[model samples]
Target: MPAYEIDGYDNLIAGMVQPIVTQSIIINQATDAKFERGTVLARTGFTEEGMWVCTIVNSEATPAEEKVPVGVLADEEVDATTAQQRATAYVSGEFNRDALIFGGTDTIATHEAALNAAKIYTKRVVK
Candidate 1:
């Protein structure tokens, strides 16, 4: 008998996202090696030249800016272990509440208002 490998897909988006607005951002390598889809992101407030670098939203982050939820990562997986990787993020969209990823002790309630301010809405999906 041969061993088999199985992979499952996780649907992150739950509602319509007309226009499909997206933003190209750099995922800071220091933040985390890999991030799954629907991972909440926050701008580190640092820009090299012009490209913006972002990290997972952390409630305990200092300076306040980094604590703000900016958007949700749109990539299935982004590996930035070696160096910062450029990835697409949904700046405005409706996402599945249960599918979102957060850093530290943060939860959906911790970022609901911030996300809404950024035009990112979250809703529960029964499936």
Candidate 2:
């Protein structure tokens, strides 16, 4: 399998909804080269921190111009600038890893679920 680069953002919106936006790069197998760009997945929301988990099901790459309709569920209306800022902050090592699980979970299921869901959006880029 080819190596993939995953990058995205998630913001808690209203109710139990958290919008997740992702872009992934799929390496080209034929030329042993990186794909030109990535593809957007969806514009849907997931349950906030519980109830369910979303893992990286899979990914594929294409041209950047090809816009894929991804979901967005933010409590506050997020503009393109804000989204870009969040993405940059994420890539710039501004987020706290431990803060993700600041409060201890009451149950193993809950903790495991949060970890699994978080792994989908966790990029190790240190800036």
Count of clashing residue pairs in every prediction: 0, 6
Pick by TM-score: which candidate is best?
A: 1
Query: Taking the tens digit of each residue's C-alpha lDDT, what string does model 1 give over 75-115?
Result: 77788978878888888988888899998899999999888
Candidate 2 lDDT, tens digit per residue, 15-120? 1222333332121122221111111122222344322211111123233221222211111211232122111011011122222221112222323333334332
Determine which window of 10 residues in candidate 1 has minimal summed lDDT.
1-10
Residue pairs clashing, model 1: none
Evaluate model 2: give its TM-score: 0.17
Query: Which candidate should be chosen as best, given lDDT against the real structure?
Result: 1
lDDT of 1 at 120: 89
* CA deviation > 4 Å runs, candidate 2: 1-101, 105-113, 117-120
Q: How much lDDT does candidate 2 score? A: 0.22
Prediction 1 TM-score vs. true:
0.84
Candidate 2 residue pairs in clash (backbone atoms < 3 Å)? 13-75, 42-70, 42-71, 43-70, 43-71, 44-71
